[model samples]
Target: MKKVMFTGGGSAGHVTVNMALMPLFLNEGWSVEYVGSAQGIERELVGSLDEVNYFPISTGKLRRYLDIQNMKDPFKIAKGVYQAYRLIRKQKPQVLFSKGGFVSVPVVIGAWLNKVPVIIHESDITPGLANRISIPMASAVCTTFPETAEQISKDKTHYVGAVIRQELKQGNRDRGRNYCGFHKNKPVLLIMGGSLGARKINEAVRAALPALTENFQIVHLCGKGQLDPSIGVPGYKQYEYINEELPDVLAMSDMVISRAGSNSIFEFLSLQKPMLLIPLTKQQSRGDQILNARSFEKAGYCRVLEEDGLNDASLVSGVMEVYNKRDEFIGRMRNNKHSDALSAVFRLIKETAKHP
Candidate 1:
């Protein structure tokens, strides 16, 4: 039987594309295994699947800032590379598929050393630090954004578009409302701050909730350890994180306020949900979310609210503006075109493995 190894981790953004692709390979009678940090979010997401094998490796953050952790991270990364090299040699997978993140850098390099083919997927217009490092070692670089073609080698780039999980399309709006204990009397608004949670976004949303609940039923996925049990309101619900119920929650929401992660924004666009995007500032991130937000705004899919200007009042106003103009956004999304990314990428991986 053919075998394939997947590596990506740290945040859900890095792991989501792999999650979308894994079941395909499994159904074809191929052995699927994942390599990620022992305690990262990827482990939780992928390890829960019984069919796919999970392997843990030492990983260190590829930080942009100066810190004492930088001194020890190199040693950790070096150890990770060695461990990954051995794992690849033992598994003897035909190909490696990487959804680029810090954990993926070592796995890509390990694949190269063992003469295993590697394919990478980049979700943003510009590659992240980890993806940028892995691009040259890859056999193919699949992109979510068409504009990303200009940045990578013409020969290796494939504009396959965003890969959304198929389960998201199976959501029942009424089930979502029932789960949240909400009714159809008012429009529903959902607020999400990425995988790790955005402290600033959470604070602002809570401050504005009193005003927001008057007009809409609110469902807040406020990230782990960020929930507040002290307050209970008629039209509001809060969760630290959600697993199976995410599709349902998203299906019921009429509008959203969120951090502009590529995977998430694309999912929202596909669902035709009008959004008010509050992108992380350059200080918080590498500014990719800002670019993602701008592209969505340009296409009339969402509204952008930069983190520097985010506050209770501004959050309220942004929500109202999006709520008022929701139809325009919905119309644009309805008419938009998307590539069949899941099938395209799956085919590419199969062919790459065949040659290797």
Candidate 2:
């Protein structure tokens, strides 16, 4: 059987694309394996899969700021690379596909050292630190945004657009409403701040609930242990995080207020959910979320609300504005012609793989 190794982790954004594509490879009689940090969200997401083997590696955080961990991290990364190199050699996968993250950097380098072909997927408008470092070692770079091609070699970049999970489209709206105990008379709004949840977003949304729930029923994914049981508001339901019920919840949602993670925003875009995006501040990140939000705003897919200006009042106003202009956003989203990204990416990986 043809063999493939996938690497990416640290965040759900890094691993989601791999999760979307793995089943395709499995169905085609390929042996699919994953390499990621053991304690990361990727381990839980990929390890649960029965068909794919999961390999844990010692990965260090690739932080930009100065810290004591910086001194120790290089050694950890070096150890990870060695471990990855040996694993890749033993597994002898036909190709290595990386969805850029800190863990992926070592895996990509190991694949390069072993003379194995590597394909990378970049979801943001600009490459992340991990992808930027690994791009030179990759056989091809697949991009979600057309503009991303400018940063990489013309010959190596392939614009495949967003790869959406098929399960998301198969959600049942009624099931979602029943789960949330929300009536269909009022519009449903989903508030999510990535997988880990955003403290600011959760606080702001909770503070604005009196104003928001008067117009829209809300389902809030407040991250793990972030839910406040003290807030007993009608037409509002809160969960620490969602899993199997996510698609159903999304299906019932008429609009969204979320952090500007590329994978999530694209899913919202694909579902034509009018959105108000509050991207993480530059202080909190590399300013990628800011760029992601701006790109969506530019395309008329959503409205951007930076975290610096976020407050209960602003949150309420933003949601009101998006709710009123929801039709316009929906119209524009419907007009967008999404390419078959899953097919294109699958084809790219197959073509890039070496014939055994």
Candidate 3:
């Protein structure tokens, strides 16, 4: 059997996208191994996955600030690269497929050093630094947005949309509504923060509870540890996290109010759900969220709202705008088609296996 290595961790956004490809890999009889930080959210999720080998490495996030933490990061990264090199050497996998994150960087470098063919998928319009560095070294760079292809080397690019699960592509709205207890006539608004809920978006939604409850029923995925009792809106249902139920919740909703995380953006598009996207602007380096929002906004499937732009009045107005033009949003979404990222990865593995 061919051995395949997948890397990326930190947020569920990266790992969830990786998980979407697992079934295809297994069906093809490929041996799959995951390389990621032991401390990432993936530890909990990937631990229970059957027939998949999980190898932990010592990856750390690179900080942009001038502090002791920044100084320590290089050491941490170097250690991770060493660990990854040893793991890749032992596994001798046929190919490496990376989803962009600090955790994936070391493994990508290791794969490059070992002469392993690497394919990376970047989910945002502005590629992450990890993806930027991996681009020249990678055999192929898969993208969710066609606009991002121009930013990378032309010869190495493929427009694969975002790798989404088969379940999402096949979810049903009628059954989803019954499961979520949403009213047939009233619109359902699904609010999400990547895997970790955004405090700002959660607080804003909580503050607007009274007004929102009157107009809609909400399925809010409050980040795992950040729930506030203030989110006790009458028509709102809260989840600490929703892995199996995500498609149902999303299917039931008419519109989504979410952070512009690439994973979430692609999930909405695959479901063809209209959205109001709030991109993070607090940090200087958070260019990916802004670009994800811009890509969908350009496609006419979503309206981009910045942090300052989303007060209670504007959130209400934005919801109304989506409600009024619901058909237009769906019409625009019809043009959206994500690639078979999992199948592409499987093909690459087979090709490498043949050569090996």
Best by TM-score: 1
Q: In candidate 1, which residue ranges exceed 4 Å CA deviation?
A: none
Q: For residues 234-320, write the lDDT of model 2, one tens digit per residue.
A: 999999877679899999999999999898999999999999999989898888889999999999999888888899999999999
**What does each candidate score in C-alpha RMSD?**
0.9, 1.3, 2.2
Error of 2 at 131 (Å): 0.7
- Clash number for each model: 0, 0, 2
Query: Higher-lDDT candidate among 2 and 3?
Result: 2
**Cα lDDT of model 3 by residue, 1-356, tens digit:** 67888998888878877788876788778899999888778876777678889999888776556777777788889998899888899899988989878899999999988888888888888788777877888988878778888888888888766677777766667877777776688888888876777788787777787888888888888888877765455678887777766677777788898888887787788788889998888484557788778877888989888887778878878877887888999998987655776677556556755674
Per-model lDDT: 0.93, 0.92, 0.81
Model 3: per-residue Cα lDDT at residue 92: 95
Q: What is the lDDT of residue 302 in candidate 3?
A: 90
Q: Model 3: residues >4 Å from true position, as ranges? A: 172-185, 282-284, 337-342
The candidate maximizing lDDT is 1
Winner of 1 and 3 under lDDT: 1
* List of clashing residue pairs for candidate 1: none
